[model samples]
Target chain A: MEAILKVEDINVYYGSIHAIKGVSFEVNEGEIVTLIGANGAGKSTTLNTISGLLHSKTGSVTFMGENLGKIPCHKIVSKGLALVPEGRRVFLQMTVQENLEMGAFTQGGKTLDDDLERVYEQFPRLKERMKQVAGTLSGGEQQMLAMGRALMSHPKLLMLDEPSMGLAPILVEQIFDIIQELHKAGTTILLVEQNAQAALSVADRGYVLETGKVVTTGTGHELLESPAIKKAYLGG
Target chain B: MEFLSYLISGVSLGSVYAIIALGYTMVYGIAKMLNFAHGDIIMVGGYISFCAMSYLGLPGWLATLLAMAVCTVLGIVIEGLAYKPLRSAPSLAVLITAIGVSYFLQNSALLIWKAAPKVYQPVVSGSLTLFGGQLSVPYASVLTMAACLVIMAALTLFISKSKMGKAMRACSEDKGAAQLMGINVNATISTTFAIGSALAAVAGVLLCTSYPTLQPTTGSMPGIKAFTAAVFGGIGSIPGAFLGGLLLGVIEAMAKAYISTNLANSIVFAVLIVVLLVKPAGLLGKYVPEKV
Candidate 1:
């Protein structure tokens, strides 16, 4: 499979503290690749670096054969990589529909109607609350809105940072199902999650991260069955 | 009947304050800075219009347009040179920088125009006789109030319907998420300054026309009053600025008539203190609880 995204030995620092230490990963076309780790294991940091929100101190991030080092964070979305940021940072003052419209900022007005229809079809709850302010939405609904907003850009590779974070078990399962559905629709996904068991269950491949380094890499089934992963992450 | 005249004059003054307050509220909303230099921009606008009409013999409308254009460019330049570099700096640092810019503009105007006050020719002269001349409204006052209403309506529509306006709202709410969504936060901020400065120019023109005094310090008092007005209405709300400006003007006018003129300013400020103590978020501002 063709690699849609390639991260090579990227190092990142926040002030004096090193956050990501020479981490490397790749997501191929038509794959649901997950980076599973505990909190502060550099999952969000790596995704942010890829999205150009944070710059790497060393190494490179290449998306669709383009080096993303010099690209501004705002311009990164136009290149077809979208990050549904952690905490579901939807514009709180904006209406649900306005928030979704902001997601399609890089696109022309031509595709907006059709894109809105598709997003609404995916999350009917968002459509129901389209006129309501986003801050008023429930957590699960906010997550769906964040995801729906990202999809508005027609992203080639969607990177989700802890979409299931803070969600109830049922809502978490629903979000994972949506991830799988999007993957089947032919979009590559790079997911970061603390929910290792659910991540492994839905991921085609998984990379286990510990203390800013990838400790192990395997297929979903392999990671699920591994005694080390089960003890460390899956709660054996 | 006498009280009605005072109220009318107060509304006229309030309209000018409202225009200036719009400048403050908008820049504060998007850039998250008080932009203390905003009042100085009004001074610059007055000087520009004064020069255009007196030296170049331009028509009143043309001079006002020229002032707006110059102020717009100046706003962008000030934001780029003074505020843009301090984007990631602390709010205190930005506020200090704004104050520095304000002093710089005042000194520059002093050197260019000198301290002598210039008498501004009213852009619109004559008065409307109402209730058999017992109530007379100056054309300048009518024009100022009309301009304020039109500007408020236009600005409201622009912010609600325009793509750039939406981007501005997004940036104001969350800059990081806005950047993630491909909205250029910096450009939105610069655009905000441009619009604010242009409005400052209009306010300057209207103010000078009504009051008939033009000096480097002309913008300072009104600027401070309008800032007070913005806070009274809610610093980040557009409609709040309008309501606050009108109310402040009327209160000031009423105090001047009923109370001592020397105490009018004091009463206006006292009202602000009371409002803040009562509401804490201004009249219309939302109280966002800090996330622990």
Candidate 2:
């Protein structure tokens, strides 16, 4: 399997504070690879760096055989890389349809209707509330809207930062189910989550990050059953 | 009859304020900064139009178009040079920078054109006498009001329907999310400035035509009044700016006629204070509660 994304020894800093210290990871063409860690463990930072929101001081992020270092953050979405940012930052004031339209900002009108149909088919709740203001939607609905919005770009690789965060347990399961559904549909996903159990349950492979470094890498089952991961993340 | 005349003149003045206030509200909406230099842009537009007409012997319509084009370029240049670098800076810092730019433009105009006020030729002359000459409306006032209405409608459609307009709304809501969605936020902001400054040119021309005075300081007082009008109606709302401007104009006119000319400005500001105390978000602005 070809690696769709390759992150090599990237270091990032926020002013003088080094936030990401030499982190590296990869996701294959058709796989759900998750980076699971505690709060402030640099999981979101890694995803942000790949999406071109933050620049790394060292190393490279190669996506589809092209280096993403020079591309601006906005242009990165057109390059088939989309990030569903933390907290499901949907445009609160805009209508649901407008929010989805904004998602396809790079694609113009071609394939827009078909894409909207596809997204609506995937998320029927959004269709029912297509004209509703996004802020009025419940937390779970907003998550789906954010995910659906990213799919509008027809991204080759979808990077979701904490899609399950702040969601109810049942909604978390639903979100993970959608993740698995999209994975089976042949979309490559790079997920960052603090919910270790749920993440590992759906991920084909997982990396355990601690203090900006990958401490363990294995099949999802292996990480799920590992004693250290079980104790530290799985709440053994 | 006298009251009706004052009301008509007031509406005409309000129309000019409304046009200028649109520029303020738009830049404030997207850039989340008060481009205090906006009023000075109006002055620059006035000077540009004045030069094109007097020095170049251009027709009124051609001169207005030329002013709009020049101001559009000037707006983009100003954004690139002055405001773009301060994108991530604190809002207070941006506001101060805007003030600095305002003074710079004013001083530059002073040096270029001198302080002597030049009489501006009316783009439309004569008056329409109504109700057997008891009520008379200047043709310039009619043109100004009509121009303001057309601009307001066109701008409303442009903002609500255009792709760039949607991007501007997105950027105003969340810059990071907008960037992630592949919307070039910088370009959207530049477009906002361009539109706003172009409108400033139209407003400048209308203002000079109605009042017939052109000077470096011409845009300052009206600019300040328009800014107040924006805040009075709701700083970020297009329609709010329109309403606020017209109301402020009527109030000033009524005050000058019924009360005292010296007290007209005072009454206008006092009304704003009262309105703000009643609705802190302005008449049309949404009251977004702070997330604790």
Candidate 3:
């Protein structure tokens, strides 16, 4: 598989505190890669760094073959990288349809109508409540809108942070199912989650990040059986 | 008949206020900064119009257009020089810088244009009585109302239907998410400021036609009044600001005629306070619950 995104020995700092320290990872085309970690493991920080929300102090973030180190967040997105940020940051003031339309803000060359249709097809509930304000949507609905919105950008690499963070167990199952559908539909994914067990279940490959460092990388099944993973994350 | 005339005057003046309020609301919406220099930009417009009409001896109509163009460019420059650099600064820092810019522009105008109020002599010196009552509607009033309505309509269409408008709305709603979607946040914000300031210039020109006297501090009353309109209509809602301005104008005018002119300002504020207490989000604003 060809690597779509490569983060090589990148370090990110928030003032004096080192948020992501010397982290390295790669996501191949058409693969779902999960980053699993406990709270404050710098999983989100790494994702943010990749999405250009935070600049790296050292090393490089190469998308395809081009260096994305100096690119602004909007330009990074135009290069086909989309981040569905944590806590479902939908435009609360806008309607569901408007939120989806905004997703195609970077579609400089493509027609948005096709993308809008695709998003509607993927999330029928959003289509039903297209005129309703995003903030009024339920938690699960908002998560779906967030994913649909990212999909509207036609991203080569889709990064999600804590998609199931505040979801009910049933909604979590549904969200994971949607993730599986998205993966099957040929969208490359980089997922960060605190739900290690569930994340490891669907991920083709997994990275265990502890305090901003990648501690382990393996096939999902392989990581699920590891004793360190079981004792700490998968409830023994 | 007397009350009707006040209503007419208020509507005309209110429309101008609404246009000016747009600049404030748009900048606040996208950048979350007040752009306190907004008022000074209006003052600059008045001065520019004064130059074109008085200095260059152009007609009022042509002078107003030129002033609008100048003020628009001024607004874009202010964004580039003052607001853009401080995009990531604390709100307090940005606000102080805005005030500083406003004061600087006003005082600079005093030095350049002189502190004395310029009497903007209108080309049309006569007023027509309409509706069988002694009503004074200057040709300038018609021009102002028409221009305000056109701009308002155009802006509404742009925001609701245009691609850049969608980007602007997105940026205002969620800057991070909008950026992630490839919206150039800076460009959208700058465009917002430009459009807003241009509208303010138009208001300033028309306002000067009605009053014909503009000083360094001419923007203060309208500035504060438009701010109240922005809040009254819902700060971020484009149409809401227009309605709020009209509401305020009518309220103040009616209060002055029925009650006392001295109490008009207080009455408007009292109404605003009541409206806010009843609906914290302003008349047209919706309450968006934050996720803790």
Best by DockQ: 1
Superposed Cα RMSD, model 3: 1.9
Candidate 3 lDDT over residue span A22-118, tens digit each: 9999999999999999999999999888988889999999999999998999888778888999998998878998898888777763677888888
- Tens digits of per-residue lDDT, candidate 2, A60-82, equal 99999999988889999998989
- Which candidate achieves the best TM-score against the true structure? 1
Candidate 1: list runs displaced more than 4 Å: none
- Model 1, DockQ value? 0.94
Going through the candidates in order, what is the number of backbone clashes in each? 0, 0, 0
Q: What share of the true interface contacts does candidate 2 keep?
A: 0.90
Give lDDT: candidate 3, residue A60: 98
Q: lDDT tens digits, residues B191-218, model 1?
A: 9999999999999889988988898899
Model 2 segments beyond 4 Å from truth? none
Q: In model 3 chain B, where is the ten-residue run with the lowest total lDDT?
A: B120-129
DockQ of candidate 2 against the true complex? 0.92
RMSD of candidate 1 to the true fold?
0.8
How far off is residue A167 in model 3, in Å? 1.9
Each model's lDDT:
0.94, 0.93, 0.88
Which pairs clash (backbone N, Cα, C closer than 3 Å) in model 3?
none
How many backbone collisions does model 3 have? Answer: 0
Candidate 3 interface RMSD, angstroms, 1 decimal = 1.0
